[model samples]
Target: MASSTITPASLPPAGQTSNFVDPPYIGGKFVAVNCIFLPLAVIALGVRTWTRLFVVRSFRWDDYLMIIALLLSCVLTGVTLEMLNWGLGKHMWDVPLADFMAQFPKLNLIAAIIYCAATGFTKVSVLVFYLRIFPSRNFHIAVWTIVFIAAGYSIASILANIFSCNPIAKSWDLTITTGSCMNRPVFYFANAGLGIFTDFATVAVPIPWLRRLQMPARQKVAVGVILAMGCFVGIVSCIRLGSLYTLLKSTDLTWATTDALMWCTIELNLGIFGGCVTAIRPFVRRYFPRLLGLSSGGGYTSSQSRSRKHGHPLGSIPHSDRVNFTNQDNQYTTTLTTLRGAPDNGSEEHILASHPSGHAKDADGTTGIIRTVEFDVENSSTAPQRE
Candidate 1:
């Protein structure tokens, strides 16, 4: 997507040179895409941060990494916009040779570096978030391996772009014919191919574990939808690869590379947006329960009450609230309380009430007598003791 000067051989015959060049109108498209999508991406990130810090109250490493990714994305957007002013989105012959050589290659190198950093941290953030929920040792190993590969590729891409040409300055200053440069088209294709592969791998990693969770069908589908947003990012990566092909084959560099630049921006920004989607579910479920058709009274059912009455362990019930029991006048009562938010470690605490007689049984032949009541608590750690 970088700009390049037209070689002398590309020029028209001396007598046929025209005074005016037709505009391809690429700058407007670049500006329009940035104006529309960048703010939405930023807003999504903000909502996720608020949910993690204030609602869940359990911010972790993934949140920090996403913040870094968002920051780098902002830089990428700003630099790319600046590039339009430096002869981007114009035919190479339309641009003055001095202006094209002075700004195009240097600015392109900076954009590439930022792109690698942004994408690398974004994938790492996703894997780190996965680590919090999935406890399988083998899954952990697999996620960490992907993280390492992502980091290594990002570093290598940055270094390759920085040192692509001998005497580095020669990459921008074409006057220095004594230096040589790597085959840039081959490098671009390889880097983009690896990126697309990792995108698909990340999308697939969480599916099996999510399916194994012991939750209701409705809940599982909700979780799956959030994780599957990565598939959209993968789709955009494929589109970007095609655009890169067009860019590499094009001799009218600035005019033809607009599609490539636009898709690159979209792919990275959407990565940030998709990473934020899963973290904000608590906020949606809390303030907008009706949006998902969740009942306001915490969705308790009669069977759950009966299970508590018979002294059933809380672990046997899927997605049940924390419960406490009390014994009085030869009778047992159960009190259920909801935790303020889902715990990061997926563990819950329960309190079971027992009689001093040690051999008591209910009239129905149940091993223990119990009754059920329910309430909500702001913090699981501060839940009330049995009275």
Candidate 2:
């Protein structure tokens, strides 16, 4: 077997000394950050899954998609860490040429594919969540459009990465010496641009609907903040774009790509965090009411109070009697009259009427009133009776 070697002539140009031997290898930095972040991402997704399946019992499409995204993110992190052992995050020339050719491009290509899938699925999960909450036709159309765009971008990016080099093995095996690749930096920048666009779209699609929700000011703000959490993902994507630019411009491929990889990891994890945050609210409401300052009795919504007040002892209620009141001071009135034939056996006639006033407090601690009416009639004679 021939030993691999690099001569002085093979070194990067002047002012690119960082591509050669340098002190302070930073491969461990990727490992350390992944250790801290990957677990947190998994924990966030786990809590969300538990909350959806058990606490709320309303697990839907979004939850499953998010789980897929989490699994992909796990794969991405594992691949990224594996690459560190193969000379990622070091000066390029410091790596044995054979090891570099054998590992970096192949692992990077796999990571990029996983990255696109994970990000695309995450956006789908968020948009699916929005579809569940907002039923307007326009909102549904908008969300589906974005989902399609994300899917398209993911497919395009994966194909671009896979075919970036001819005789695909040449992508990783530089010694092949007879193949060509696409303009990699241009392809990377385009991919990053698409990622940033999708991130912004994911955050933007819900803002108008959030603003129109009829809720107390504090509740509105809380909902807005949660929905807007994707903004952090967008910010990280922008930073990742800058890192990609740096990686493209520098001859220190390993060192320059380190920042890009780090930012990508952060962006994906933050996206997972953002997706889980909304679903975890119910769990928080149940287990940590004080954390959100919610009353143990329940929220201030009138529907909840009405259900509590009028629900049957046998857990049945006349659906026809349901009322929705938008104004606290608004008064509603309903009357029921009933006629009955004489009972088979002699019995006394009876009539019962009840009026109840219910109080519901707003999230801001202001109180409101709800009124209820009930009536019951019993027949008394052995023979039939006519009005």
CA lDDT of each prediction against the hidden true structure: 0.72, 0.71
RMSD of each: 10.8, 12.6
TM-score of 2: 0.74
Over 4 Å off in model 1, which ranges? 1-22, 297-387
lDDT of 1 by residue, 1-387 (tens): 212433321343345441124544578888888887778789999988888876566678999999999999899988888888766777665655666676776777788889988999998998898897788998998889888988889889989988999998876676799979997766877888889888888888887887778865666677777767798898899998998888788776766666777888899988888888867776776666555556653333344444433443334233224333322222222355432222222122323334466533322222432434443222334444657
lDDT of 2 by residue, 1-387 (tens): 112344321254556542334534877777787887778889999989888776665668899999999999999998988888667877765666666777787898899889988988888898888887787999999999999999899888888888888888777667788879887877888998988898899888888887777765555666777757788789889999998998888877777778888888998988988888877877776677555667654333223243432221121233334442222222233433221221111111223232243344423233444333332222233223547
**Cα lDDT, model 1, residue 93:** 58
TM-score versus the correct structure, for each prediction: 0.76, 0.74
